[model samples]
Target: MHIELDLNQNDLEALLHHCQSFTPASGDSREDGRLADALQALTEALLEANASQ
Candidate 1:
């Protein structure tokens, strides 16, 4: 299944900020790495969404 989100520019920006500033607890390098990858994908999505408007 697919998902959809309806977020305004400010909401998207705030979400991006939170994702960029997130830091998982120490000793969880695997989860931290996954978060980093997700962040990268989210950032790209944010840019693409903005560009489409």
Candidate 2:
């Protein structure tokens, strides 16, 4: 299944940047991890909905 992301370019770029900061070798970055988790959950939900169709 495929999913189309409907986010503004700036917001998406910001999110990508935020997630980039959460690397395992980086600083104690739980906050960025939360952001990444939320993004993944949201994407999964969107993709699952399309798969259900």
Model 2 has a clash total of 0
Instruction: Please state the error at residue 37 of candidate 1 in Å.
Output: 0.5
Per-residue lDDT of model 2, residues 1-53, tens digit only: 54567666566666556554544433558865776677676655644554665
The alpha-carbon deviation from the true structure for residue 25 of candidate 1, after best TM-score superposition, in angstroms, is 3.2
Candidate 1: global Cα-lDDT?
A: 0.80
- On lDDT, the candidate that comes out on top is 1
TM-score of each: 0.75, 0.45
The reply for model 2, stretches above 4 Å from the true place, is 1-28
User: After best superposition, candidate 2 residue 40: deviation in angstroms?
Assistant: 0.6
Per-residue lDDT tens digits for candidate 1, residues 1-53, read 34467999899889989877887665789988887887887877777887898
**Minimal lDDT window, size 10, model 2:** 19-28
Local lDDT at 12 for model 2: 61
